[model samples]
Target: MTKSAAPSTEYPGLFSPHQEPLPGALDGELLYSWCARFHRLSGNSKASTTSQMLFGHATTGLRHDFPGQLGYFGAATGGHLGTLQEIVQARTQFALHALFLDESTRRATESVFQGNDRSQLSRTLGLSRSGQVSLTPLKACPACIGEDRGTVLTGWWRMDHQWPSMYACLKHRCLLNVMANQGRAHWLQEWYLPVELREDQWAEHTEMGQSQVERLIHIARWTEALLHQRDIYFDATLLRHVYLYQAKARGWMTWDGALRFATLRAAFADSHRGLEALPGWEFIKEVGSVNGGFLGLLLRKHPGRRHPLKHVLLMAFLYEEPLDFYAQYENSKLILETEGPAALDRRLTDMQSRLIEMVESEGKSANASCLELGIPTTQGLRLLTRKNVAVHRRPRILTDALKAELEALLRAGTERDEIARRLKLRKAYVKDYLATQPELRNAWEQAAKVQLAARYRAHFLRVLEDNPDVPIKRIRRIGGNGFEWLYRNDREWLAENLPGIWRRPET
Candidate 1:
């Protein structure tokens, strides 16, 4: 049978403010190995060295020296080595001391050095005479290390102070300065040091009494690690204020006090994984005073401790904090949850109604109307009215009176040529119109042939009726077939009946 571990004991108050201890430091070899591992994980070239891995450089002549020591090179002041790593290590060491030691020991150790000349002791370590000394252990930072080692460095430095301080170094100084200036360092000294320190038996600089320095270093390292972790998840510049506020609040407040209540509430957001399960403002009220402001109002009215105001307020602040990402995420979620199928259905229904209306307005026979509506006639028919709509317009035909006139002339034995001359219309027009009519279609079709034969007989009779001055042969020669045909059919008859007179040529 497998054995299960016992549940851990809980603190009496879930909402009580607690000082969480920093994680333990890895061994020196492990740290070096981790640096190498970090380089490998980052996909850097295998030719890189540990210093290059840590400092972002690959120089062959880089130097290493003890913390807070300075070196000189050809009239130039240089010292310090592994500035970033050392500062980070110092912070970790301070945080660890704070975690393991009691407040009195921490305080007593902090009080040992009154002035800020941390580098005064560097002379004993064989550093350059022209180089300045930094009194504060935190000032024994990475740049200080690099300066002592005669190597170039990168990152933050105070221009007026003439010392390059890494971000980690500055943070440590800031935290301590906030405590010291605010008169709260004693609070930490009182709460975190061991009980034996209460008797004043502890000697300064002894390993037993190094807890305070250890705490400072541990806090620095832990803070650095926390910063690194946060950088992985968020933009560092944006969250810098948050970390600063937390540090200030923690240092200034009485043990487990209301200092960070608002900040804590703001940090707990639903979007932050696993935070929904944690008691936020209720936890704050349990440990802090009820008269503190909006949080206090919540605690007073909602004593049930289940009101969602805390969570709501937290989410609101977080959404406000990172305006870009939060707003985009919120908008995307709303569009996804509310718009998909319903919006599509509404659009489709509108299209169908428009199609129906268009077809009904333009009838099926009107192809131009279908073109105007951007739909093919076949598809448009589907949308038209179900009833078979009829069109009344048809092709025009010749009238009955016109057809009868042509038929009477055709039956009269009067020559077709004479009839055409009397009508004064084109022969083809009369023939075509007569042929198109069903009643006279056949008669008109054969009329042209019969008309030519009648013209020949008429021409011979007309020539006998009217004798001309010219011989028949010359007249036939001058007129040829066309004039002879006209003369025989109608011209000769007109000349014989009428008085002799010259006529103009037909145009």
Candidate 2:
């Protein structure tokens, strides 16, 4: 239950001849929330009256995130709520969204917020397709309501609590309580506060595991940190460099700037596990390959406005802290400023050439070459491919020593294709050799089938282990080729190892 505050009785008309005192905004309170509070206190029968008086139009301040026409509101209030820029930075999510935008878009968005013809604000910032207040229910923190009661007279909606990325409150560390109504117009005409809502008006809280709760808190904190950073803005190109740099450190990208997307997806899936519970993060649940989803759009060389929340989510996953991400960005900016991108490209080309030399000339395995050069095996392989050097295929003709090695690997239960790769023989060559040696083929097939079944079984079980709550049917789609292989070859083992199918209860 929310604590209640008595409406003020002094100063009758808010915008009339009497000129009643307007309510001051609470710290971190939303601009729409401040106006709603005023409407309630002013005893205005129509919401339009308060809207017209404050923002010179009925719908100007209706949008919660980017309430346009701040100039009118600032003038109407006689500059009581501080400057227009001050109110926008302090009350709205402008600063948070600006952090991920380029300088031109950031300025355009800021201008829209302060200008008269401001209908293009959301589209300018790429928030027209967002899953924010328009799509979700109004959210309030129960713990925050109780805390706000002590500081202010009534419980008000918090700007940070309303973020699409924020499933939990940063200070409370608990899930936000959502209003029952999910419509965008839930508060359009009404002037009400969180304290005035009935018990039945709130939605049932979604239960989450302790780990999920902690993950939500971590993301919420990062969002709030970005929200408060009014002056900082990131360039899209610099951000891409920062991400690529970090990816290299984690062996998710090559020295020549080619991304090992499969490796990256697997690692990102692990890092981003359980974060899809928050709204707008549904895309993260289904990991996409290269050039697919938000990950692809963000890494690409473009001037598009990727959502700030997504940027923060990636930042949180890549770096230990926001400061660490900022430090990396600063490093990239410094490199670009001093050395320039051409020098960086040259340095990468030199590194790739060195890696090729180590693998092709020195006869070192790609993995061994990478380890010696302090890089990842994937990087070495990609670098070798970039140089058109096929170290594995150089000795194509099956020599006596190569045949012996391939046969030894086959007898040890290695898959034929893998044997082909390891010995630099073509896959077709391995297949043709198996066709002639019938008895050797039978033994190798039996051993390889068993090995493959076990390997895929482990992979399928690991997917289940990572996402225990996902339905088995959905798991089959996302669990990779292993699920299909297991279902076809070893149904009995898969059935025994897999958890029971998940189903929703009937209403």
Candidate 3:
């Protein structure tokens, strides 16, 4: 039967997310070619669209003015087009035009301002602080249309001079004294200047409050400075003082534990200087180490407790170390504790008992116990098979029609090959079947044994007959005494067993 189709979800995105695969679009060669092109283009330094070199005029030592430069600006009028030609003449003419226009516009704006009637000008034209008349461009230049076709130009007039004030404000001096002192006080002052704040309000605070805040800030600053020092003066001194105090109270802390806790505390505190610090194990160690102390008394009562406690301490160290180290240490500790001198003999005895139980319960031989301990299964099976008591049971061949046919064939004097072909059986099988019959099998065996003995006996007799003068003792010796032993044991029995072979000497 044909297999059922796989569920659609099993082939994710194959049919849905990307319809069926496009015949030629998914070609790997095409993708590789595109990738090559992209890499080449991206790495090319001389590509025109992204050239790194600057462009300038040699004579004037100024940036080169191209046709495209001012083409993006939309303010140039019909008269301004003529002014753009004649590079040197255009510059002078443009400056003159700007000066004349500025003076005229200034006079007009000043007359309006002195009139003190702001509503007339406000209705006709909005006046800015520096009173320059605003006019919208009737049409954009070709370059401006191409570059900014989709963009709004409402703030284009202010774009030229807008960045100057931002640059100036960057240099403005901050009035930080008005705020209360904070550690990194300059950072707070920088934050406050841009937002408008009254100086007088800051001066109204009591001098004592500011002094106290400054002193606290100074302390915080000093603490930070002490922490950053590599020589370890103040922090180490503080840790030593704390260490001595804990030691004096309980008199049990180890130097190593104290040093470890001090180091951990210093590193942790440095990262979180403004936060609360973690408690160390100095007190615990002190109590544990003191004579007649809580932990000390426990240890005194149980001398063996120190090893397990030390193992636990070592585990804590491993927990702080890498995972591989932790696993190695834990595994080693478990094996050590389980197989130590105190427990080795008992453990081995228990293992032997367990192995025996496993074999007995499973009805398997001792070899199966080796298999349970991860021995090769095939090797274990072979070992167990050798020990199997049932192996002595002889194979039983049942009498059937096939056996009767073979007997009939043997009675008819049929050749083994002819009998095998008639019964559609192998020659070996026919031979084996005939051999199972007691009378036929015994006759065949005796005949084969007699023939073998006769050949050797005939050779011996021929040697003796050829040399009649030879002594009987020497002749017998030459024939071998072992041959005589064989004749005495089986010669008469073989003659009686193979009467037909005796009658037909050739057979």
Candidate 4:
């Protein structure tokens, strides 16, 4: 039988507030690209119509780096794109700047994006204060566009190409093409894709020395990696320590934190002097003369201002890659915390000896030893487990009735903290107890998934009911978390309940 389509009446009316038919994100696709695709597919006549449907404003999608109203977008699409956290980490440039922001500022950025502050995000990230507004045009890779033509309708904007100082395409190892003569509003306010650009609008690529080209490419690759990495975070103090560690190793600074500024400055300037010709790269020419410059500001005891592009340039100059620098930063942290590697080794030895003496020589129980040492029982037990020493003690009694009750609670989807509170038990103790009961753990896990699936299913249906203008093709897109969860854990139910594309109800 031929497949039936959703009814014409069920189609979302023109300029519907609900944004449906949003595409699944392509690899490394920018949030801007995702929205642009929505505008094209929705057949909306004006850019503001798509923006209003997706972001509740005409200009929200215009901001590339810190796209506000993310919470609304997540809710509007019923979260099929991703949760707010997923959207922020995977689609936005937040991580690129997050490496340099303090913890509080980072948290604030999260709040702004995930909530309805509607404030200018650049100011919050200190971009305005640092005079770091991005003036460069949108960038694209010729090779990427060629490859994209085979799969997608148009080449989407990439997250990595939007970096302010990125001049090379990391994946293609070639110079990126700029959208020549197109004002910011032309691209940001319109649904212009890479494939839509006319031949004359394409700018000629600038020539650079091979060494300069390599340096720019190195910085571009580093920026790309930073954009995708979710786990790395560095603040002022940690960044300073890591920079000093490298400086000390290279004899560019004294062991006591004093830098030979003249020696370092000359070398840094020379390392990047050839890059001055590249558009937006003129900053390198004044590296030696810019007041206090980046070297002094970055390495100072307290840095007042930070620009992410400069940090990328400096980090690229210092380390082979971001992950390698992270490893060195970890070592620097250890040295800072323990005074030195020798001291760190001695401290570890002492800790091991104390754990041994408390558990073995002193004849103390694991709980007792850990309590006396002011450490967690889990830690103490781990040490004893490695030594093949059983922790002998009076076990906290788990009666049959209590065990049944605990299992029931777990299966009921009670949160761990709430369960602990009602049962008059410590949260960690309950956690450890759960770890020992695999059968019960498995049952609880299954129950949790079932409960979550039911919840998401209800939410997904409710969203559809509230936004009847949404088309059936768009229905799956708006299911967000509910759609994602049900799709993964209960595919049969999802397939069964998902409305027929051609079966929309009459109004």
Candidate with more favorable, higher lDDT: 2 or 3: 2
Q: Which regions of candidate 2 are displaced past 4 Å?
A: 1-18, 102-104, 115-119, 128-137, 185-187, 254-256, 270-277, 289-291, 343-350, 354-373, 376-507
C-alpha RMSD in Å of predicted model 1 compared with the true structure: 45.3
- By summed lDDT, the worst window of 10 consecutive residues in model 2 runs over 1-10
Q: Tens-digit lDDT track for model 1 on 1-507? A: 101111112222211112222122222212222232333334445433423322223321121112111111100111122223343233222222222224554343333221122353232222233232211121223333344344212211121111111112432332121011113232111111111122232222222224333333333333322222221222222222233223332332222122454554343321232222211222333323335433443333232221222322322333322223333434433543588534322321233344454444544332333333333444444444444333322123436865567578765544444554554333445556556676655554466546654665455445534545544433333311233334434565446653332332211
Worst 10 residues of 3 by lDDT: 160-169
- For TM-score, candidate 1 versus 4, the one ahead is 4
Off by over 4 Å in 1: 1-81, 84-230, 233-287, 291-507
Q: List the residue pairs that clash in candidate 2.
A: none
Candidate 3 per-residue lDDT over residues 288-332, each given as its tens digit: 222522233222313221211222222222222222332343443
Candidate 4's TM-score reads 0.60
All candidates' TM-scores?
A: 0.15, 0.64, 0.14, 0.60
Q: How close is candidate 3 to the true structure, as a TM-score?
A: 0.14
Q: What does the lDDT read for residue 14 in candidate 1?
A: 16
Instruction: Please report, in order, the local distance difference test score of every candidate based on alpha carbons.
Output: 0.31, 0.68, 0.30, 0.68
Select the stronger candidate by TM-score from 3 and 4.
4
Global Cα lDDT for candidate 1:
0.31
